[model samples]
Target: MTETARDRLIVGLDLPTIADAEKIVSTLGNDVSFYKIGYQLVFAGGLEFARDLAKSGKNVFLDMKLLDIDNTVAKGVENIAKMGMSMLTLHAYPKAMKAAVEAAKGSDLCLLGVTVLTSMDEQDVIDAGYEYDPHTLVLRRAEQARAAGMGGIVCSAEESAAVRKIIGPDMALVTPGIRPAGADKGDQKRVMTPSEALKAGSSHLVVARPIVAAAEPLAAARAILAEMNGALAR
Candidate 1:
């Protein structure tokens, strides 16, 4: 099936308050259909907000990045599954990933295992006591996630091609750290343009500041979507 621009874009709602989120949604209007509600909004009573989005017929990517004991993560996945979210993210710990897979077995939710934060570099991985490079670690985690029956993986675009090679075409590769041309990288250590990410085999691109923080958010979103569509055309 041919991919639509909307299918390839997942905008992050990293705003602080529900009101701010509502404003962004209102501003972007129909230009955006999928949103990533991460830790900040989730902690600030965003599950109810998520329900609101679902009720309004918009897709939500709940980016809680849950990390806990097997049973705890399973319970969390169970609850998120019931919310009708399009996708949910969790740390790629073996036990947690397996438990989440089991919990989401009969649900429509797609569970994604987060490999590494785009903000972390090789030195940061080394500082964290890992002897391997970031790509090696990401590939290892991607394998583990696939083995555990995760629907996909959250990785930087720089590593998506290697991950696609390892996991094959069916596994969803959702790449974050997407920056448009001339945009700030923020704290993200690994980043790519929208076209670069798509060419690297990203099934979906998660973008935040490049769109949300722009002077004209809708225009910014359209620009990124155009780049994404151009890549798809190629």
Candidate 2:
């Protein structure tokens, strides 16, 4: 039950520029196996930088969280897959989620449906005009994503175990809002320590600030990896 690179960390490239992202990635080196390209990077460099990174033998987690009409999302997903991404993010809407999943089918890519953003809280859910509690809404949307044939979900580690119990083992759980033990919470509202996240059954952990902004990026990554190893040992 040792932790593998595929099962563990996904470093978030939340930098403002491609150069900054590359700087961080170069600093961290191979301590991290996967990197997440969120809206910021996609907006900054379009998809070419992503393609270059993927071609360089790094796993790219494209966290665009695509939410559009089924046809549009399907086409977008197809294009994204063509760029050789390992995973892509989509909202848990049935049509878009299904389209995304269908696009990833028979390809080496995985479509990850976002349940509720880790930056959001209960008030954020209410503000969005959702009547359900944030946790309940996350669970409900996760179920919807699964029913729509998505490969997995993007949720907080807090809800991961419950979702796993509902969705079973075949579906992967990619939990963002992960901080290493004793790290600052920053803007994320629903955060968990790395070990807690893995113990909650997260198939992958998305970490940003703590690793990217650390004084020693590689040491920080290794600290996170050590935590994951402890969880796997348990």
Candidate 3:
């Protein structure tokens, strides 16, 4: 089967309003197949925007990173599955993760465990009272999700190589904290370029500012796609 572009990258809609998000969608169109709806835009446009995007043929990755009681999160997952979202993120709690996977069972939707926040560093985890190293934390979370029968995980591109090694070839690794070579890292600590991420076994790379904040958004998207294409060619 021909691979879909949506499998390659998930673009974060880091813009302020629905108008800005729609503008980016109009610019890239089918060049990008997956769009991430996180706290900001979901708060701005509500679930209707996500449903509209899915209706218009864009895969939605709902990045809520929900961490809550099993029943509440399971209901949320059920609602998202009914809405036809292809991917949803949940924090790595064994019961919650399993609940989410069970909620999505037999549906096309995928439940992804969030390993670690891209904005966090070693000190951040320590400050939060987690004694393990960030890498160890990510892997442990990934293993938890795997045992829960979830589809995959959300981790930084820096940890993609190690996560891939631990999870093996079949389990997907959707990595964020991806910056193109020479782009500003901004608040993110661990990051990788598109080519580097693909080479490191990331099933999909999530990029935000480098493309959205670019002076020319479409050009930026094309450039990242080119980088991904180059890596595939190699």
Regions of candidate 1 where Cα sits further than 4 Å from its true position: none
lDDT of 3 by residue, 27-88 (tens): 88878998899999889984788999998888899889998999999899989999989889
Q: What C-alpha RMSD separates each model from the true structure?
A: 1.1, 1.5, 1.4
Candidate 2 lDDT at 190 equals 94
lDDT of 2 at 133: 86
Q: Which structure is stronger by TM-score: 2 or 3? A: 3
Model 3: lowest-lDDT 10 consecutive positions:
1-10
Work out the TM-score per prediction.
0.97, 0.96, 0.96
Best by lDDT: 1
Which residue pairs in candidate 2 have backbone atoms (N, alpha carbon, C) closer than 3 angstroms, thus clashing? none
Regions of model 2 farther than 4 Å from truth: 1-7
Candidate 2, lDDT over the whole model: 0.86
Cα lDDT tens digits, model 1, 159-217, are 99999998788888999999998999999989999999998889999999888888999
Quantify how close model 1 is to the true structure by its C-alpha RMSD in Å. Answer: 1.1
lDDT (0-100) at residue 222 of candidate 2?
88
Candidate 1 residue pairs in backbone clash: none
lDDT of 2 by residue, 130-227 (tens): 99988999889988987888888889999999999877788879999998768889889999998898889898999888988888888888888888
